[model samples]
Target: MKKTKLALALTSAVFASSAMATNGTNMIGIGAQSMAMGGTGVAAYFGAENLLANPALIGKSQGTELIFGGTIFAPDVSSEHNLGEPASPGEPVGKDSSDANLFVVPSAAFNSRINENMVYGIGMFGTSGMGVDYQDNGQMFRAQSALQILRFAPALAFHNETAGIGFSPIIQYGALDIHYDGSETQYGTFGLEDAGHGMAQGLGFGYSIGGYYDAAPGLTLAASYTSGIEMEYKGQLSSASQPFAEFGMIPEAFDDKLEQPAEMKVGASFDMGSLTFTADARKIMWSEAKGYKDFGWQDQDVFSIGAKYSTKSYWLAAGYNTGDNPIKEQDGTTTEGATINFFNNTFFPATTESHITVGGGMAISKKATIEGAFVYAPEVKTRVGVSGIGDDYPIAGAASGDYSETKHSQTAATMMIRYNFD
Candidate 1:
């Protein structure tokens, strides 16, 4: 039995390193389920370890079953400029705003009980995804026209309990890409077009250890902590206008490495007759991370919580979370007035908090379970210097206009199908 379990763990870790690497729900949790539950799996089933939320939550269940699912994600944004000075909402010269775009994602998981007390499973889920299109139209219409940012992860887990405790170690894989166009500040608005240009890309890796403890009958508490990974990316750099010019190629000196923030995670679940209540808290150590390499960046803290209720026929859950921004203006960047700049923030953002989620599960048959979930996460708003598109800026061109922040939001849904094989 020990040999078989050991093999499973090694195989799971190996698979994880080759596939995905993602972090935080929104730099707060991992995904919708954890996000719906205040950011961690406190009351979740110890089934497949596919989702990266909590590696310890995946375990074997009686019956041979297959679970397939998907999520549709939508993001929105809004920005207000020249604040403190007071500006009209209809006035276009001072502030501008737009939505990122809608995203459709899919997920799958398979779980099986090795015996009455052992379980193992694997799943494929989205760790993170980002997109923007502020420049689809003409560049002159806005101060800055651009698009950029991406970070994603996929993982696996294991669980077993005869009465003592359950343990799981998760391995993660990650990759991020960023791009953006340069914008300049004019009379009262940020200027747009290929004024400046640049691109940055990176690969990251990391993992965590987690476990479950049964303090009472049908009641257990789970805890897991993760250390972030760092990735230094290199790409082409140039002004929006002079792409093939002197600075067309990204300079080695300007190339940079950024670290994922470390976080402490805690969660628990209580079974009450036919109901289950869950809660979770997490503290992301953004402070441990470094600012952007050439442009400069700083990390921020994140917190979250969630609850769930279950019955013989079905189950429902919900949660919320908040965090600090990682974007900061550096003292001396290449651009004169612009102290420092950021090209891509998929690995970093100024507004990294505030999310709400809801989801449920239903029995499809005596041996199968079907589930679905939805989340509403509005974009965050912040200020930097003079000109700012929303936070979802493009991948290239670090210094846009100066002194301004951006806003962003997210809305998404997920569905899962599972079969139990005893």
Candidate 2:
């Protein structure tokens, strides 16, 4: 029972804040400085936080340092649908906001100079996930789902006056839970009950490699690549529960694995006296991923730009980031296509595309610094199920005009404290 409760807590946290993430299911940045700077850290140095962005930057650390932080993420999400007719009379066709709205993500890192030319560090961060809860409202088939991912990375870097390179071996833990009440829909009376089979958990391994070069005085360029991690959650996708078994919606032979997509990034930072500018561009190969590709997710290209001004005691930063939504509406010409489209929008609405960020840092003492950042993402709307439903489909009142629309927006605040040791 304790394990069940823990699973439920993890599941609820991920689902509640899923849409608050900016780039697909990923947070725009890891540390308060990075978050404030529009997630552009590839070519920039921001103390120990560099462990997650470009480990090579650790070589630039002044001395042993420890940084800890958390983000309060809040998402505003709502769904409205008129899918032909309700299974029971008097069900309303209107929009309703999800009660799940807030979550906190934590991060910490420790880095030290091993020698004159080498550095080592370890970092733990909440990396990626997606989910939503519409259970109480029941507007979109009472769907609820959550995916949580965490990464533990240990890194090593070697550098000289002009260039540096680093590598980190990554261990990732993931949890997934999917539930819905299809019984009240025009579709067949079937759904994956909440906690019916418990939450599915797995671990996977990957690696990140990066290098940076000081092209000129006050100018740096860097690039990095992260490998994909494949994980399988036993019994989660292929459970043989009663309604799921009877409906035969998911074939028993289906694979239960979902692979995190690989990422490639390149960035540059220019420092001019008291001001600095940074820019980055990255690509996420979702089309090549396993579960995501099967569900019609496309590749995403993300771009970020930021600027910072610094004085002896304080620094202020601002940034902008944009990415195209990876999940696109499918041409539901076949029953199978329509079903896949319905599931994609209803359960995994990773549709946020833009973010604006601002932040500042203050030196409270000779060895202690505090940083804070705020991020906002404008609302984005998407609709699905408009394509004609074939006659062969088993739903009772589903019509060609039946469709569901979702609106998602987000706001988050991050705070971090950094302590330096002589």
Candidate 3:
């Protein structure tokens, strides 16, 4: 019993420490080196961290290696709306910032050469998530939510002089919680009350495949694909709570399953003396995913470019990444559409669209190196229901009004230490 309790506690803590969504519910990159280069690792070799990006790159390693790293993520998110009439006179319905702003995402990886033509690796990473805390904002609904995900990947790669291929089987763990205040008599003949489902957890499995070819002495091309991971957080979306049962607002078909979207990436790298340049194009299939599709999310295309200058003992890197926000304004003409829009803005606002990254690494010795990176995503603002819909959208359980706006931005810093054992 004690051992089981301890395992549960550790699992909870690990899930709580996961990060907010950056690129369509996924992190821009896995490690400091990849992040500093705008997450462009499909064709560039970056040691053990490559397990998540392009496992084939691990085959480029000359020896065994271990890496430990963490990211400090901070997101600034706020929401404002007059959609619902005040429950009481002068209840202060204005802009409110989310308190779920800071988190630490940790990662570790180990890679070793099995033979002249084979390499193997394993990695554990806090991959993606999004959440908000509006409970302290004094808003009528006091909406709050949290979604977190972590992944463990074990991979194998085969490589020869100028080509490499790899595969990774992934195990994923996820947690979700949602809460909101509702009103009685808001729906014609039904009563809606506040609801909270502490936290729902689940596990899923997936896979990734990648390959790289050295086309010439100084150029390389690569591509990778990650399959979607399907998870079911029981009692999260289809709970027997007041908002779901009493009011019958959410559709029964919308169940408790939320699938992580699949991703495809293609990239190229050119090396010139001591300088290297890389570019990557990626597609996130959110529109085809189960849960996000139900929430009206669209597919996203992301582009990234990076440059690095290296010396005998140190290296400097910089890059830029951009993507269209997957979530867009929904049709407010209907109560069902308006309700979906309301939840999208209030609970899961993953709206940041651009990122600037800078980083560097220094060699401490022949076997040890330290690296760090910083990422900044400019603020993005979105507004829904600009035109008045009605006074009562009971499906949303709040007063319907002219519009609601959400502003989101983020910053993250990562640090890592690597050791090579030859």
Best by TM-score: 2
Tell me the TM-score of model 2.
Answer: 0.90
User: Total backbone clashes of model 2?
Assistant: 0
Better of 1 and 2 by lDDT: 2
lDDT of 3 by residue, 1-422 (tens): 11111111112211221145378779998898889998788898889998988888899999999999999899888777665565566452456788889988889999999999999999999988876676665452555677888999999999999999999999999988866554422432333245556799999999999999999998999999999999998876554233333333332323677899999999999999999999999999998876677566789999999999999899999999999988777676555445555556655667788999999999999999999999999888887763333434344544456666788888999999999998
lDDT of 2 by residue, 253-349 (tens): 3356778889999999999999999999999898887666655678999999999999888999999999998877766655555544555554566
CA lDDT, candidate 3, residue 366: 97
Model 3, 227: alpha-carbon shift in Å? 0.4
Candidate 3 backbone collisions, by pair: 83-399, 84-399
TM-score per candidate, in order?
0.67, 0.90, 0.89
By TM-score: ranked, best first = 2, 3, 1
Cα error of candidate 2 at position 148, Å: 1.1
Give the whole-model CA lDDT for all candidates, comma-separated: 0.45, 0.76, 0.76
lDDT of 3 at 348: 61
Which stretches of model 1 miss by more than 4 angstroms?
Answer: 1-35, 49-51, 63-65, 80-95, 115-118, 136-178, 183-204, 236-252, 256-259, 290-301, 326-352, 378-380, 384-405
In candidate 1, what are the lDDT values of residues 362-397, reduced to their tens digit?
A: 888887787776766665555455333222222243
Off by over 4 Å in 3: 1-21, 86-92, 138-140, 183-192, 240-253, 386-398
